[model samples]
Target: MQKQWLKWFVVGMLVFVGASICSRSVHADDSLQRVKEKGVLTVATSPDYPPFEFQVNQHGHAKDVGMDIELAKQIARDLGVRLQVKNMDFNALLVAIQTGKADLAIGGINPTPARQQNADFSQIYYYGGESFLVNRADAGKLNRQSALKGLKVGTQTGTMQERLAKQKLKGTHVVTMDKATDLILALKTHKVDAVGVETPVAKAYVENDPELKDFKAAYQLNPKDTGSAVALPKGATTLQTAVNHSIQTAKTDHLFPKYLKTAGKYMQVNTANTSMWHYWKYFLAGLKETLLISVCAVLGGIGLGVILALMRLSSLKWLSWPALSYVEVVRGTPMMVQVLLVYFGLGVFINIPALPAGIIAVTLNSAAYVSEIIRGGINSVAKGQGEATRSLGLTKADALRFVILPQAFKNIWPALGNEFISVIKESSIVSIIGVTDLVYELNVVRADTYRGVAPIVVVMVIYFVLTFTLTRLLNYWEKKMKHT
Candidate 1:
């Protein structure tokens, strides 16, 4: 009887283990578990495009106050989770979904064939018409695509309008901006001949801005390309199905128009009259990020720069040649190009946080210059110093460590300071990829307040102050070090 009982117990344990193994597959595949675990559904967006997604001052604070915000909130509410918005460049939104940085992406994103390859799309949540917005003075002459030949046109990067502009208006130079707000500024400043965008957004800018009176929507795009859908990470079918159901529910309830009407009220409210002190928070937040990236980049650049410098200075042709090539290539290109490549191109393959990626890109670009600076500094040191170190019975590594780097750094220190300052200025480019630097926040403030020039001037003053103060201090430090 005891032997029989033991056999049954063993059988029961095997059955339980098999069931557990089966259940593991279900939990591993369930993407919704994360939403429940975290209690927040993060949606990635670029909120500069008003009415769809934008910021507005709420009781002395900037809030995600737009149609998309409301729509996302509703979806979150339906899922019994809190809503969190991650603002970034529209071009980066799909990348956010693909890398699982954001659970969902909704920014009036039209489901395009190219984007579909990278991620899945929910059902269309909203439909909007595309139209040509041109300078009001030239509206009559440049209304048609044929007339736009040879003129520069602007569109938000990675958008359907960009593709359509390329296809329909072949001769037009399609200048891309990362945000709708920037495109509007480009159109206002005559940087672009016209901008092609969704009709409602074009209408919002024209109606909201007194200066935009000179811009007019020329004509509508084709009928077939108006659907805007939410994007989900690949293999997130369960979450995608839930989002599609929420969107369908919103459509059935006429939530789009209702959200737009409510968002319009907030969008038009002039927050310029509010205490400028209230908006200081945006700059403060930006300052923190700017410092973070600049400091981190400088430190990271120093480390990598040392490595590259040593490689370039090596006796071996193999080591020196590759390092030389890398420095030349990086130095030859613009920092902006490098940032885009790392964040967008390499991001497709690697998990890159916007902050770390920005830091990494800046460090890489800086490393090239830093390497050259360090190499120059090292060469400036006397050849006798190396001989002396070797005579002291030091290894090559110990010679570099004890006798070389200390003196090289002294010579390179001032140049490194200038590099740091240049980095602080160059850091502005990272804003395009959604780093919450001063530029990014100002972009938000400009759209939210519609007082575009003041926000820009303010940010410029802040940047100038930051750079100038750092320059003066660096100069003082150099002078004091000379005495030492």
Candidate 2:
């Protein structure tokens, strides 16, 4: 009887494990059902590449309008779901899809074999060639690929063009930037001899700026290398099928030309008013987001910091050790890594939006530094004060609340204020994750207007004003505290 029972138990365990595997498989491939259930297909893209995906100011409101966005709409329509676009850095787009932040990524992605290992891709929707953008004065000399042999060539980071430039352009220095606009800026500033970009993108820049001109930068190409495709999560076969179908429909109906035409009109409108004042609404919106993230992060950091400080101060080994470790770990690493980890690492369990992720990361990062500042402030308080409270028959918690904390806060006030200022400045890093902080909007305005330095100057002035005003306010508070 015992042997028979053990045999049945083993069989039951095998069946349960098999069922679990099957369940996960279904979940992985249920991308289509997930979209329909939510009634929205979230598409991710880096909108800094024009004619492929870029933003335009429409009646004082910024809107995304490009061929890639149009294709996303087509896919969403075929899936019977509304389309929701999420703008992120180009490097973040594939990771966004892999982490379930979006249903698909359509930012003129090349469906290379290396990328295929990470995410499934749809049929190529658009075929494009490469070109090199150079100053018109040097166009005759640097027009061909061979001419770039010993010059600096700039490409957008994480792009096929970057890889090609590095691999194929022997004796040339290859520089990579996060945005196509930045690459153009580099070329114009003479930091790079030429900028490698998509043929259409190069044409768009050359048409707008007479100083720039493009010529073919040919390569020994594969079919996948020259075309753009939509990326989906790995094992999302159903979603890939639907997206491929949408691509086929667009191709059969000859809709690519129409998409490009629509994008060109928006681009023309965008360039019509390149003055910084014309895009005041964009700057205003960005300022609000920056303030919101900074204020929330600082406030939340203070609260968490107090708790951590208390934990570190505790006599209990477990509490104090963990608190110490957390502070050291957070302090030791770069904040950018923390931001990505919180945005994508924690995303494996929960889908946090970019704004909240930015806030959480900054809050957590600030807590560590704030905790150390608080701990130092607490230490600065006279030990005799604690003894005096104890002699008065006050409990430890009451002593901390009434005497120690108030004095500690008074001591740390200036440091805390400096932290607030630091957060306001450092918070610009959140732009990489698509939070519309002032810096993010600065890049958007740069791309849309194609006037990089002007937008940068405007953002720089705004940041200076903000930090200077904050410094004056902090000085005022410090004086008030001293009097108190």
Candidate 3:
């Protein structure tokens, strides 16, 4: 009878696992089919780019409408597909299509050779040049591109501007600020002598700000240079051709110019050139830092958590309550508040700087949660396991190490992975303290170019790629560990 029951239980578990796999496969297939059947192309873009794409909060949820966005929508309409704009960072749009997460990227993306390796590009939509923006005082002194040779120039990291600075203006000291906006601030505050940015961006800035009127564009660098195009994933040949036809139709109708005027009404000139790429970089950087912090915190927290968990599970009330209270206080408050308290608030009482304070804060917070996971895992181990170890002449510590911990860790592995991912997403908040991770970069880009949408879309793609990659790696490790 017992054997029959066990056999039935094993069969049921196999069926459940098979069902889950099938369900996931079906969902993925359905998502792809729905796009084709409904004739709706989901294009991800960062609407932060002015004259390109930016958010219009007409009702409540933000709607993206800009030159590139309208162009994309028109393209979709031509293809008989309803255009669904998924607002994101520039960098993210590429990754979205690459990862089979989105259909295409349509935000003034320059179809560089490097990008083309991973994605296909439609015919060029917009042609533009790159230039440098400097303070009025500096502009006069550095009138020529050659004059900027020795001066510190800021540019959005990973853009064609950065590439130009490295290749064409080798001697010029280049500071890679995360965003064009931040570059502007750096110039405004005398942090950098000038910023290498696109021509339209510089023109928009000088036109919008009276103070910036003094800051002239120091001769157009890389004139009539690059063109922007919509990017589709490498395997998406059908989608690419459709997008190309759409671009051709839109150009004939001069739809982009009309859309630009409509989008320009709501966008601030200061935040326009913020592209998706800028934001993607920031988010990826943030994800990396968050992962680093989470790993360090989890390791530190596990060590401390184990000790606290043991104490809480101890017979002595005195030992248990203090540890329990520490856990309560940490778990009670939001992680953001705790992060601020440690990084900023505690600066009054303690002189420890930002990075260390952040590490300590995250570690403490992680420890509280780790303690609960540990406690639950420990409790899940049958009492017999502990008794068996004790009966074999093992001390409490030995029993935990040899018997209890092994089982506990296995049970909590999935939960630990979840916590790690959560920490990664949460790390964006650290940018508030000037941590230059991901979001900080986005703010900088937004401030300078005023091409709002592209940079943010870029940042989102980077983060998604980073977090998704990490999650996969962790899952692989977990599976390997389980087998071991």
Which digits, one per residue and each the tens of the lDDT, describe model 2 over residues 146-220? 998889999999899998898888999999999888888888899999999988898888877888989998788
Pitting candidate 2 against candidate 3, the one with the higher lDDT is 2
RMSD of each: 11.2, 7.0, 16.1
How well does each candidate superpose onto the true structure, as a TM-score?
0.81, 0.93, 0.54
Among the numbered candidates, top lDDT falls to 2
Tens digits of per-residue lDDT, candidate 3, 402-481, equal 89999988888889788777666666665544454566556545543444455667677777877798789889988987
**Candidate 2: stretches off by over 4 Å:** 1-28
The digit string of per-residue lDDT tens for model 1 on 1-484 reads 4345545654674576456434433534467777878999989998888888988866646688778888899989999999988888887788667655689999898877778877788887777777777777776787666777899989988888888888777667999977777787788789988888887787887777655533333444443345788888777788888888888898899888999998888866744453456688887888899999988888888899999999988988778876776786687778887887677555545658788889889989988999899999899889999999989999999999988988887777889899989999898889877898989988988787666567788888988998999989988877876776
Model 3: how far residue 216 lies from native, Å = 9.0
How far residue 111's Cα lies from its native spot in candidate 3, in Å, is 1.3
Please report how far candidate 3 places residue 31 from its true position, in Å.
12
Report the number of clashing residue pairs per model. 1, 0, 53
Instruction: Say which candidate scores most in TM-score.
Output: 2
**Candidate 1 vs 2: which has more TM-score:** 2
What value does the lDDT take at residue 62 in candidate 3? 35
